[model samples]
Target chain A: MEMSAHNCRLVFVVLAVSGCAPPDSTSEEQLRPVVPGGFDSVPVPVHNPLTRNKVLLGQQLFFDPILSLDSTVSCATCHRPDAFFADGKAVSRGVGGRPGTRNTPSLLNIAYHQLFFWDGGSITLEHQVFGPLQNPAEMALDLASVLQRLESIPTYREAFEELFDEAPSLRGLTQALGAYQRTLLSGGARYDRYKAGDQTALSPAETRGYKLFKGKAGCLHCHHGFLLTSLRFENNGIAISKEDSGRARVTGLKEDYGKFKVPSLRNVAQTAPYMHNGGMATLSEVIDHYDQGGREVRGKSPLIQPLGLKEEEQADLEAFLHALTDTTVLAGIEGP
Target chain B: MNYRNNIFIAVNLMVLFLVGCDAATSDTGSTTLTLNLNAQVNGKPLSTDPGTTFDVNGTLISFESVRMYISEITLINSNGDPVSILGDGLTVPAKNEDDEDISHTVQDHIVLVKQDAGIDSYDLGTWPAGKYEKIHFKIGIAGTNNRIDPSQVPAGHPLAKQTDYNNHWNWNAGYLYLRIDGKVDTDGDAVPDDEWAVHLGTERFLRQVMVTHDLILEADQPGILDLSIDYGEFLRNVDLSDPDQRICHTMNNLPVANAVANQISSAFSISTDRKRTGGSTSADG
Candidate 1:
């Protein structure tokens, strides 16, 4: 608990000192920018600078519901802890029974995320934050009115006063939420431990799955790196066009017509209803989608080729993917 | 709150002050040279285009947004003998459209913007610095390349809609060096009906090297140098029409890569006729 607070403070320091640092790389990973109080993906928007006070302040706003229309739902409502900050329902219920087009992606390691939406439209975590807060289907509150709502609450007003010395402002609200979001970094998984040099961490099946994923399975093509995602957009060889325009809407390029930003499988087993349109409900089905080269979308990414994985290999890969499960970040995140 | 902390703060401030003073005094006696860069893109000046150009062919051309970039201006003192111009080169904008409608022109419109025509001018505090002689430059990527995953390049630069460019290669994690397109008569039909677009880039043949030479300038003489890029030669020399010799844009192509690499490098001949690098880049690439 205390560790997260320190990480939050470190995040603030990174934001404040962003312009001075290089973008997302380190001379050595150990020498990363200290923020909220530990190291993770370099604190995003180093220009915004996170303060322990700011993150603590942001968390209060995240759960306060004061920023919502009816004051009934906070960002944490659908994004609860027990489910990796993602509501496990095929589609999460938003403010006043509003249903969002895409499933609630797990906010785990979101600070390390490059593009925000499944279609890769919202380019930054900060930019995407506004969508949920203002979407009539989501929190159902306008940003312009959020400041007024915060000021109405003495708790929010006093909290802002103690953290910023000034009353609540739009910038303050954003900075606070941004700060709080950065602390939602969830790692310490089997893969992280293995990469950090605990060779014995993975079980036998998981080890084979990891090997297959990196080699023949080609899962690593989109799901690459320590962040577990190359963060690229692809058609995923599934029929994703019926629902969303996919990445095509963001980039009007015909080639990207059915593409969508590949979601990180950090806690994949938990966040079900896969694909940008939530067409695949199980991991096995998703692997099956890749086994057959994506349906003939006019502009499918050339990378989406048929893998032809055997039944056992596919099952083993799923087992290995399950090792990515991280229960800590989703449980009891909000507390004193 | 502690006395020692206060003393540390004072020491730090003193150090910063000393560094600032040293920086100010060390460099001196150079004239400020400013070049007003004017680029007339696609036969029409920047003032003309409704801010977008239409391309007829290529590997899924998403004209949603685009930008272009060219830096490292080596001003040549074409006066007497060959003298290389040097000093500070300021890349004013931070890489996108939000900075201005101009920076994007540097990143996109590769088919249009030029060093002098599209790139405009340069000012080195005053006049040209160093032994100004013949100038040389590469029309592409510089070192301090944005090392981070390019995912945020869109947010950093919302103006050009750069987030939409899928010219990147999935095989390797890098952006396509260049994308060139135009109708090609593979069978030599009089009409350009047999359409083909060249997709170039990736780690292999990223060498679309464009260079300049023999630039002349005297104190009293006119010093505007223009480079002519004969697109005709680009098509012929690069063999844009030959299907066997030319690489097709079927997700990947190499001969087309080699051809563009060879032609664009040799096609850009420096001439003294116009002020900038040649005919305005046809914004529709």
Candidate 2:
């Protein structure tokens, strides 16, 4: 069934507000999938159904700096909600100002993804929680230490006991964090409206840009479908310098050297700079790079060719991309 | 309900189901339409060899590579109704060297064809077996299909593979609609002065070409529709001597792309009995 753009936006706003309430026995109905247009039912692991209490506890832990070794940085430090759950930096800085190799991908609609990170090393959202918590450049705290710290806090201890009927455990912590992230959905963009059969949702330039995007521009070859990402790895010539091995670092295959996981374009306007390295500063720069074709490098995907877009056409394409922004998702609403 | 009423309802339902089946079967007969692509320069088959030079407005040029994408195929029925042949919006790429038929099926209605590939034919899906005249197709990919990421295409699809034939610019998020790289001697000297690369793309570069031809399709039999693109005619309108149109490797050079795209629309036509029909479309560029 099709939904009007306005109705879709209203539905998402209601879902977002209602999902933010504290968990209770009657909150079980809230856990039902609230998928928007062009999306299927959100895959929820049976072992960990979304609950208000779990999401609230996870939200608290995410903002709390106690997860770090020095207790000075929180998950919010890198995945800032205001920044669309991505720190506005080329590469995110971890605890003690240590830098990472790749850019911090936005967490908007991350629950819909089957893999995580630019390399896609993490298989599940629960598994991904350990990477930042234990990475030397990130939280730099072991699970045992994190649990001990949480157990020492009277409030955290009571909360954990009340929620899990036990003390803070590694499983509970990751599940709670994953639960909160699963609720971080980005929908109601103008693009969504346009897809909902609202012809006037986009300007003429954006409409032309959308046509170009599907036609001559060829962005849909990879970034297609509802989430706007294939979620696969490819070498788009961004690794020409060989400074980073990308996915090869994990797989150790020569052919996989420059390949990196394709990222979703949801909330892309808010999450920048773009690319795995965050090299391109603006959408124009990114468009220019593709217009000139990518850097001629070994293992560059054959798809990289010069686009020859006119200045006005480039502007139109940029405007179309801007229309993808969902202001509702950018509000940074925190639950009580 | 009474048994008599229930029996009567059952008979009506069976009759309605039979009629629905008959309606579906009437449109079930299908035939494939094969589109053949060939190139020529001054009545000779266009060669990729650097030694083969063709004079264009007093300039000697030899093409090192030539490639393009064709999409939005439509067959005009006898009644003049345009029948879209793209089912499920999938694209069938040109035949590769391994004789592998690589087709990338996306959510868009178009197809990719490489010029260097040997006599490639795209077997568009089955249609109602009949006679069709006037085939219409665009010279490049168009619409939302243009911005798809090649990586998302199936791994073995030509566009998804890591090769130059795909001719996609990932950074620019577009496809190279047409790429003609060659060496040109502008000074009328024996040796080539500079390398000329005419790479055209972007939404503005999209050109639509319609060719009038007689295509007869029989049940389960493939119908052949041959199209010839004259490389010489493709450069007929463009002044190669002009520096502004001499080399275009980026989107900044729209004038050159416009000139070439205009020529391309006029250059393509249906080849019948070794003779060609002049079929062209006006370029909006």
Clash counts per candidate, in order, are: 54, 33
* Real contacts recovered, all predictions: 0.00, 0.00
* Superposed Cα deviation of residue A290, candidate 1 (Å): 1.2
lDDT of 2 at A144: 68
CA deviation > 4 Å runs, candidate 1: A1-41, A161-166, A328-336, B1-285
Q: Write the per-residue lDDT of candidate 2 for residues A145-204, one digit (tens) a residue.
A: 887898999977887777666677655676788877787777779999999999999999
Off by over 4 Å in 2: A1-30, A240-243, A332-336, B1-285
Q: How close is candidate 2 to the true structure, as a TM-score?
A: 0.50
Best by DockQ: 1
TM-score of chain B of each: 0.46, 0.76
Predicted candidate 1 versus true structure: per-residue lDDT over A1-336, tens digit per residue: 112222222222233343344322222111233422123455446434555456667766666666678877778776765567777777666778888787778776677765567776554454456567767777877655776777878977887677555676654566578767776766656776677678888888888889999999888888877777877777766665455667665544567877777788888988887776567789998888888876876777778789889888998899899888765443444443
